[model samples]
Target: RMELLEAFKTYFQQGVANPPGNYTSYIIKAENISRLQKLAELLTKNHIKFAFGGNQNARGFNYDRQKEESFSVGRNDLIVNLHQPAAVLADVLLEPKTLVSDTNTYDITAWALPYVYGLNAYASKENLKGLYPSLDLSMDQDAKTNATQLPLAWAFSWGSTENAKLLIALQQANIKVRQANAPFTIDKNDYPAGTLLVMRAENERLDKELAKTISKIATSQDGIFKTISTGFVDKGKDFGSDGYPLLTSAKVAIVFGDEVSSLGFGEVRFYLEHDLNLHPTIISVQNINSIDNAQVNTLILPSGDYKDDIKEGLAAWVKRGGRLVLIEEAINGVIGKKGFDIKKRDTTTKKDDQKENFGSFANKSKSNFDDAIPGAIYKINLDATHPISYGIGNTYYGLKTDDLIYKPFVQGWNIGEINNKSLMAGVVGKAVRKSLDAGLLIGSQDLGRGQVVYLATDPLFRNFWEIGKTLFNNVIFCDY
Candidate 1:
């Protein structure tokens, strides 16, 4: 308060002594006029000489004619509306990244994203005539799609009994079905019950490891055979005839499961088929327990939804030096009983008490951009410089304490201590046990012969496609 008072006194004395010339535009908001009044008091009390407009333009305070008047201050004066022209507020809040002559190029989606999108929204439309006039409408478009519909199981034979039921419903609806490896093992005499089988490319230019998987599938008695992968596309001439019918026309198709595809796999498909000039033949699998016949370069599990078999596979894979990406939910669900334990109190089972385990639907989805949440983004102090944050801002993101049910993973990430509880901004904690010296959130740990990069947030291109697209590219695609 004293500091602000002193600043006002300084400005007030200066303004009163010179009476602010017409060359300067003294803009003020309605709510902030009180500050101006305080400053006026100081000037009057000190009896300092001042002016309102300049000597040449005595009536008009020579503000730039090009700049539009944001408030109803009229003619010579200008008003700045905080809510209406928030971009101007942000412009004054965040310092723009300085241009460098070195290799440090600015990332479009990483460093200058959310703020850019936010400011662009709050900027007056008329004021932004030439700057991205096309996206003016996108600010009002509804981007939220309800995830109410239960995903149909096109290849139910590969999943559990519940999966089978889902597949049957889709089939009855005339949805195309495909069969892959079953989540559970069946008797050798068991028949193929799936709707369709999607053949994956065994030896595409990028997937050289698929040859052994294809050979294994051929020798197996699962009868869950698939056609040649459309990923092979023209490389395999018999797509319509011998290629995976699911890729071409099956109303319901079963592809491989992966952590990267947990949210929207359609974008990758679009990119592959259109942007990258390649066909996408893989399917995203939530549970990896059924994929024994295929060989994968990396096996990913997005936190809490893991099975015993999947864990076993992951353990073996990690031991054998394969890549694995595990989200926070998976770590809490499978590995240890440490972090936020949503498991059970004493002894509780679903059959014993229906209210005990309500499944994934019980938890509500937390909004990342909601301003109601305090500390939607926590400032992370990192170690020196790292690769993950090579091109990102000096600060990283954390969970907002304001979000319902979402809690932070770090101690210093909290906003305030209230009622004996620490209110933090970031959710989802990663388990770290290491002896080496490196950064925590954006650090890479050498596991066995391979490496594991631990990012607090799922920087997957799929999740933050809009705001952090370039950041994702730097982490996933860039060799640097």
Candidate 2:
């Protein structure tokens, strides 16, 4: 599915993929604003109630240009909408009338251009004369990096999931890598804490043509390789300092259970293999006892159930320097257990349980189930100094489906927190609004030599959230 998606995204401009059904989706390859208006007028004349949306973010369904943030260049995605019959298209929207409301149907059906046709398009309320350029998809990927003189090491800004791919690709090619734990200025460019560094001293006997080998690997992964001259930096921590740590090849195993979220599991697998180019060992809950901490360093448990023995084994593994990553509701497995136990926010109160309903029984029952969060986006406040937040900014946007709130861990670092649990997008119930007023989104609890990493929300929601993907990569690569 990801291969097809990537192919569609890569070749959609060349008219390679077939348009699903008969929906008027287009790419404005011409640098003409009037072309966009002409198409909009045609739809308007047809009396089709349409909306303009950015090509990137899945928000802006029934999009109002005035209400949403301006979809400017170099900022938000400027993609066209997938126009179909109201009856067919509205079935996937996140409204009450949306047909795919079974919760088990899909992760997020919010309209996204990349998931749909993978092109740059836009519609406007007014004839705003925006400087639009035709996207040149035929550019050479090999030209991404120049053949610079081989210095002491190589480095690149680790701000995107693409950077993670480069790091993984280098490691797979048997190239040793190191990550800077502090900021540094090389030449004139200032890199943040999570900047990936490939030192020559580490990979001396690995390859004969080392510089070209790394450049080629980086180009294949669509990463810009910046050559480092000397370890001595103009400012910030130097390489000899405790700022640079050798990155280890990820020895990971994802625990898949019978009742575990297939969506979450699939997302983890897809992001790890398809996106990041790392193949993780697949472990079933029945085989949880088979997990040898000596063989695997990181154990990822998606949202699902776990037996007492499995949980107990996980606690011991974590104490023995094994990384345990818990996603969404999976944290419930070890919440009350020892070694990995952490405090959860108390949301239950007498006000809701008491007889305070003034509506019909049918409506009351509907409201009870309606409290289940479908999906929503929220602002995250992160400790920028922390390694987990190296590439991402202080404010990270995450898409959350469940109310898996946790209290701050006194012993561990709350790398990122949602100070205000207000909805940036998507619908939410009043009860959920009050319950998730504020909570931790990303944290780590130190058990012994190992740690239990917590992700309160599904970062790779439906395998879309680009920013969230970076955060997820941090959980795997940077949070050592």
Candidate 3:
């Protein structure tokens, strides 16, 4: 649970207006056996006895209240973390769903705490060093960011969610922030595009208070105010160039109601409130027309059907310089409508599927079952030259659940697209896989003064998908 919360922090999410969530959780961090033995030693010294499960000294869990009495436990379910994860994934992909159960299953069988919680993991073929003398569960102290002396400006590489949190913090503090649209080198250190610059000249009012304010922000969000001294770079845009665009804090709104996906809505809500220290307006599709762009400049629509009377108004609003963001199925509705050139990739084929398997009901049921995509990982080709893809790499791992595809983004900024629909993880069906092969996943165009951004998948999917979290908020923060 703490790790899950840490993941949120790593994404640089701070003061995000989070809906109160309460649940039972425990972190099983076994760095080494000695740590467990040390814990056992302490517990035993205090007259508390326990049994070690899943070890060489493995004994069935049975604990007694008295010193000599046998061990006892209440009803419980023990779930071991799936190590060497390839085998199960292969089974799900290769085998038919009916092989596991012909009847409709209660829910998706996949229960992964790691990816679901947005925790990072690496599958190592070799074991890591596991020697431990003691387990230090100590938290990090408030190491406030202190500078020896302020340079012409303070520079921060736009990497991690922490930098994102800092960017919003500086914006909120009225400290003039600028983002470099091109990669730069300063003090022999190279920083990529989207590097943040807080010019000392712009914020003369924050002369002495600048570092102090940054410290407060860091302490509050557990942020790392890691900065590089700003100077004339060897390559790329200079500090005084127009290549660096001034950035403003975002006034965000997430579309809520029966038409939207609650999961999608909640993820964005949690991210904005907790990660970026912003409380987004929770407006409904019913209030689409009523959305005063003055109050909420940025509107995000999570995956759902909203092509009613509201969608047209919403698209019109975008042309008026309102920042409009769409995720997954929501894009399905508004494609080829107004202010967007994205066309939905047809799921239907010339040869009728039903007609081919007309006599076979079982075959038809199997085919229908196979079409479902329960969060498959896809590799996207991102054109990082665009500001939307800033801080994000050339390739993005998109977790695609919906097979919502668009024709090649001939118009606007084709920031992200799937060339081959690279399935990195999870099971993808024959039909959906083919359609997902080559299409635009993320595209944006300037609609009038406003902009319309289309996302083929929700970047804030289940509050997992780390890059998506950054990319989702990028719509609000990114200059482009």
The candidate maximizing lDDT is 2
lDDT value, residue 358 of candidate 3: 47
lDDT score at residue 91, model 2, on the 0-100 scale: 21
Query: Model 2, residue 242: what's the lDDT?
Result: 77
Q: In terms of TM-score, which candidate is stronger, 2 or 3?
A: 2
Model 1, C-alpha of 323: deviation from truth (Å): 2.2
lDDT per residue, candidate 2, 180-237, as tens digits? 8878887777777888888887686878788888877876765666677788788888
Best by TM-score: 2
The local distance difference test score of each candidate is 0.29, 0.63, 0.61
Q: For each predicted model, how many residue pairs clash, with residues at least 3 apart or on different chains?
A: 31, 3, 12
The deviation in Å at residue 243 for candidate 2 is 0.7
RMSD of each candidate relative to the true structure:
23.6, 9.2, 13.3
Better of 1 and 3 by TM-score: 3
The TM-score obtained by model 1 is 0.32
Give per-residue CA lDDT, model 3, range 365-433, as digits (tens): 567755777666666788979887776667666677778887766668888888663655556667777
Question: What local lDDT score does residue 315 receive in model 2, on the 0 to 100 scale?
Answer: 70
